[model samples]
Target: MSEFEWLKRAHAYDEADAEDLEGRVIAALRTVYDPEIPVNIYDLGLVYALDLDEDAGRVDLRMTLTAPGCPVAQTFPGTVEEAVRSVRGVDDVHVELVWEPPWSRDRMSDAARLQLGML
Candidate 1:
């Protein structure tokens, strides 16, 4: 599916199984950290979107790094893909790195801000 379609479908996860899997996927996402950041990518506002298809056992994720030139940019998506694929019910994972809209501190979670002393 197109990235926009995946993003639009992400909010339609209403099935109980889908919710459970989504939660697991989010938990899995929380385990991945930016090499230069102390906080996980999720809290750091790096994850732009997540679409999970329970029936297909697939996950489509959109994320970004702190900067386009970050050293791990080339390999970070693969790392995220591996993390999502490790979830029990997930059989396929596609991680897309997006620079459009660009990351800013405003996207960060309150907890992340507090942790980083930005709050």
Candidate 2:
């Protein structure tokens, strides 16, 4: 295949002409750590969903904290929103905190469980 074709395959989102910007989203997500935990919020299982709107250059996230009464409830959503907004291609970010399904230890990423030595 040609170099241009390879480039498209490497970075282009199947839905768009622009580069897939998910990496930037993850990079920014790494900067947000749970206030009471040592792990990045992403690994903590706090983030339940991430949707990138290629056409709009927007990102939306649905997440939960360890507990419904988590002390950082207010701050956590703000932090994640800020992180997402910092990504270069992100035109806007909206973080929603949900407690309906709740958060549990099982939700944690392997890395998070390992960091906490729960492995």
Candidate 3:
């Protein structure tokens, strides 16, 4: 293939592959539960971002707790890291705690709201 054609094909494949990796990362995150909440972190609106480097099997995640002073504050990030690392093809996980645009009920998924009886 010409360089132009190769670049085009690679770009398309990267988008699709990135999406698939992101899906898997989200799935893994959904399996993580907040110590005080029945809902998983993903649905609870705690996850602010999930960035994947599929070729490197690395994931860069940004998340937060319901509150800055949450009882599990010190351990939650580690928990999330372990959960994401457990997913197949995810060789490395970086979980960052973000307070910007702090988490709120409005951020929760509709299903999470219903489950929490807020709906």
Candidate 4:
């Protein structure tokens, strides 16, 4: 098989693979939970945006903590970046925190809702 074949195999990650990968990445994210919250940040409505930079094998993530004054604000960003870096194929992980819109319970994923018994 040629290098192109391998590239093709990966360049366009199928939906199932993408979902699997997202799940895996989120699982890794779960390992680093908020110090003040019972739930992992992944499901805590903190992760607001994600951009898969496939060509660079990097993932750019945008998120916000439950509160700006939260105690782990400094440590959590590094933790989030590291968590994403553990995912296979992600050469670099950039987790940026945005506060314009602010974080709220509505942003939580359905899985998170179930975990909190909100759904």
Candidate order by decreasing lDDT? 1, 3, 2, 4
Best-matching candidate per lDDT: 1
Cα lDDT of model 4 by residue, 18-74, tens digit: 455565565566555667867888778788887776668778888898888988888
User: What lDDT score is found at residue 41 in candidate 3?
Assistant: 89
The candidate that wins on TM-score is 1
Off by over 4 Å in 3: 1-19
lDDT of 2 by residue, 92-112 (tens): 898999996878888788999
Residue 16 displacement in candidate 1 (angstroms): 15
lDDT agreement with native, every candidate: 0.81, 0.74, 0.79, 0.71
Residue-by-residue lDDT tens digits, candidate 1, 1-119: 85434433443342223448888787667767789989989999999999989999999999999999999999889878877776768899999999988999899999999999989
Listed in order, each prediction's TM-score against the native is 0.83, 0.79, 0.81, 0.73
- Measured by TM-score, how close is model 3 to the native structure? 0.81
Please provide, for model 3 over 1-119, each residue's C-alpha lDDT reduced to its tens digit, 9 standing for 90 to 100. Answer: 85334433434433444447777667667767788889988999999988889899999999999889898888778878876776657799999998898888888999998998999
**What are the clashing pairs of model 4?**
none
